[model samples]
Target: MSILPQLAFVLILGAAGLILRKRILFLKRNILLGKDETRNDQPNERWKTMFLVAFGQQKMFKRIIPAFLHFLIYVGFLVINLEVLEFVLDGILGTHRLFAPLLGGAYTVAINIFEFLAVAVLVSCVAFLIRRNVMQVERFTKPEMKGWPAMDANLILVIEIILMFAILTMNATDQILASRGDEHYLALGPLFFSRILQPIFMGLSDGALVFIERFAWWFHIIGILAFAVYVTYSKHLHIFLAFPNTWYSNLKAKGEIQNMPEVTQEVNMMLGIPVENPSAPPAEIGRFGAKDVNDLSWINILNAYSCTECGRCTSECPANLTGKKLSPRKIMMDVRDRAEEVGKSIDAGGPGLEDGKSLLGDYISKEEINACTTCNACVEACPVNIDPLSIILQLRRYVAMEESGTPAQWNAMFQNMETSFSPWKFSPSDRFNWSEKVKEEEMK
Candidate 1:
């Protein structure tokens, strides 16, 4: 047995692993660039959230048709990977069907199931392509989704379709070679889906069938390795991040805005509520909210990285629905983009975040952030529990508090809240004066 294939496989796997390690490290550094905040308070609840939302895909079911199609691809991608494990083992060990003899008849049953899933994934991918291109799914055709975003979505689907085809073709060619008494190939009986494909290769000679089978096998494994590295760069990073993102998701009720800790600390001191940490250094003031990625919390950056660019958030946003410029999906994408830009600059030894440009104004416009109604519709609409509303709120807070760039009307309301403890100009005692008039009118 020549060691060449095993040696080549190890080299390819190693190179892919090294590249992935670097990419993952860069992503982690980018996430850490944000200020730290704790999301570890409710461990048990977090586990449940990850299970139901990420693993079970609970939120996806809200849209039935696309949900079912997505479920097909998701399930198939997972189950079919069992066969991929065999491929990896075989590639490294210089052997084929390592599990076949151990499991006997059950091996064939497993392959049949994998084949079925491969077909399902293939069909589902085609449907996704149609939805993105032919149907031009409204949420998919948004302005932010044009150019590379559109191509990226379609490209991933096409890759899945091709990978599924490779699996089926490899199985079909292998069965034919085994029938021709090829020594290396196994006769795993006809897999349900691949069985129908046998007639196409029946006319091919044993050598040709063997070559096709080997080519397909190599292509499939290499493709899988490539996909692993590619996903880190794609919006499909959500495939892995969706788990942790959902796990650490903001558990507060929709529209239940959490107080910024730094600002809260200052307020508590002002109200004479007593400090929790008297000896500790004073909490920094003035730099209130996020003007760049660094001002946001780590989980906020995680939410950015976990975005699927599905545009459901933007679609459901009341502001966007009413033809406003606020696109929640765009907000998340901008965060991720800005982080990536900063991270790459640091890597290149540039001035990094000090380069003058910021997430505000450069990537995301003040008008877009201001247009949001803080309705939380975007947060509720995310299938993976991403909180674009949180990012939007932070941007708005930065404009209002840090730069004092809010509109005059908003400033007036701010003054009212500070003075009367309400959002109106009326004094507290006269707040219900209309009720007094109503009573007088009724009496008359």
Candidate 2:
């Protein structure tokens, strides 16, 4: 323990903190770029949702095998990180096993528990890698996952394995050093998993063993800090965003679609209902629906950011099963990519970048939007409660209302709805005629 290591630790920790802060601020700004809507109702329900979905991971259990494996990694991540508090204090205060003397026997138990979790995490990561690469799970190899998405997934799994190994290695070497009465080495009973590694290092000289132990110690802590910052830039961001995203999730009935106030007012006027008269000049007209990220509600953007890209949504989507261009998972990924692009553009220039492209044409396409049956399957399948349907509806609204780009069949259906109050060509007065004909045929 020296001032130099403490100072280096402080600087590394500070740099990671600063980078993470900047990324978080950028993400906040990007998410806030969307239109504002109030979702602050039912604080009690919101908290319950966050606890059940994010913390409890209730939705993940739909598929028992994968769910159990995922739970191992999730629990491992949380439990193993408990040791990080000790790591921080040790690094800053130049102490070793700072909590060992205080906790007494409890320290050994905690270390053993951490070691067990570390092994579980390592095994889980390897299993995940095999699933993604060797087994080539269909959902994981979708077109959207061809490049960086695929790499990002593998990179995270590998990083977790490495970090876990670092922890076990550090513990094993520390145990060996303690046997030799090395300074600052606590003689806690050997951690089960780490104890197995001790035989491999027994032949090394005292100085080499010390170097290996210190290197592993520094690598584990530094790797964890680096990972904290890397998560903001990776799909792994859901690790943190899932909590708030679930907390602010849409709590309305699944089948309910929020109405456009302006459209509702116009419909009211057409139906001869009394409407409020404007007392002053009207506000400037806005686009009918979302042509870009800015026209979508903030929650929709947040959904994009919080997406895990697990493909459950896409796997469940009927349109995708039928070989349509649409994949709800891809839609969310596109939205996130477009939002990131816009955020970077604004960072480089100013608001002037708004004119160049949009989420509609640049990232998502009309065919994909049209393919949606609005079955809500994607919404139902999302473990994180993301509503890909909401984004689809907004983009569809922009196409139909602003661009008037619906196909001829859809246009005919729209015309029928406007005049006949149904999606058929017949008048509303004759809407029941088909039922009457069916009754007559049955009677005959």
Candidate 3:
């Protein structure tokens, strides 16, 4: 068989994968509605976040075992390409170790290291499955206990298992081939599988060994391609999206919201509010933040594309876990559904209008935004580094600043911020009260 067939196959598959990845990323890039200036506005902070979050995977490691396991998975998946390079050549060109001792033996060492991590990845994946299915970890369940689409959860599990099995199968096949005494053999005894497979392969005929090797090579190659295509359609899409998403994650403080574009006084502000008989329109107003699906910031749409739906954000969210009616997964999913709907309108050249018939009318209720604690746990737990809290803050800014419809409890707080330069509703005159009391009491 010509090596060209397999080479062409891999090249074709790789190009298809790259093209799909680019198209989706481009679609996401153009659909974002909100402020993206924060991502590049501060180069130093963006660099720091990139290094700390993307390179270090800092937040992921908060739960030590899982973090460590993911590290192995991430590093192993990256370097496992060396083995793929070998497999493609051996399978196609009929020569093993085509790049013998390539990268100054770095490739060889990577093979062993990745194999070790492969074992760890399998074990961790199994543990996670059991934790989610059997133990019913709170972090894995839906907020209302209504249960998620089991298909989505199970799809992720199956992908990880297939990935691990493919690694093990490839390593086992390589070891078996090595034991047959082929001159092309590189040392394999050091591999954990070699010791176990040595006695068995030693007894097999050359013809039998060759057939098994061919089968293994085919299985490994086909399995990996299937896995790649499957990932694009699954929640595991974040396996690729998360790193770049986190690198571009919003870094502003919770309350420091983005400003809407300004308008001239003659423009008739006409701030939107569904509430009946609300106050008069302002002197000028831009579109209220997220009044409708179309009004959402472009970054909000990006949040949808980037969402892993791992339920990590929902799990860590105090509001959702406590049953106060908030789920980050649902929020992202809603935004996604709406973005797709609005995107169709935008594509059709229709004006993206927001009246009372808007996304904000019911699903994303007024109560829901105010319910958020702004605790930042959801932001912290998000593997992709999505900041739903930022969206909520921006929504609040619109409600408070434009509509002047601040929630009652927050009304006093906003007033304090304006009058006293703080959210705490206390007189500035009383600021020295604590100092005076402390000094006098201590002296006495």
Candidate 2 lDDT, 183-249, residue by residue in tens? 6798997588999999999999989999999999999999999899889899999999999999989
Clash pairs detected, candidate 1: none
Q: Locate the minimum summed-lDDT window of 10 residues in model 1.
A: 278-287
What are the models' TM-scores? Answer: 0.96, 0.96, 0.73
**Model 3: per-residue Cα lDDT over 1-444, one tens digit each:** 567757766675677578678656545644564433445677777778767776777877777876787787677677676677777666556676666555546655666676777776667778777876898876566653334445666666667676666666655656666655666556543666324544655577767766665665566676676677666555566666666676677776745555444432223335442433237454344555656555566666666667766677888888887787777777776666556555555566765433234555445666777788888888878766887876676666667766788778788887789899889978888877878878999999
Q: Arrange candidates by TM-score, highest first: which order?
A: 2, 1, 3
Task: Write one digit per residue (lDDT tens) for candidate 1, span 1-444.
Answer: 889989999999999999999999999999999988888878999999999999999999999998999999999977988888999899999999899989999999999999999999999999989988999889998889989888889889999998998899999999888877888887886598998888999998887888888898899999999999999899999989999999998887876887877777778889999878967898666477889999998899999999989888988999899888889999899999999999999999999899999999999998898888887888888999999888888888899887999989999999999999899988898878889888999999
Candidate 3 clash pair list = 32-298, 33-297, 33-298, 34-297, 34-298
**C-alpha lDDT of candidate 2 relative to the true structure:** 0.90
Q: lDDT ranking from best to worst?
A: 2, 1, 3
User: Which pairs clash in the backbone of model 2?
Assistant: none
Give candidate 1 regions above 4 Å deviation: 268-281, 419-421, 435-444
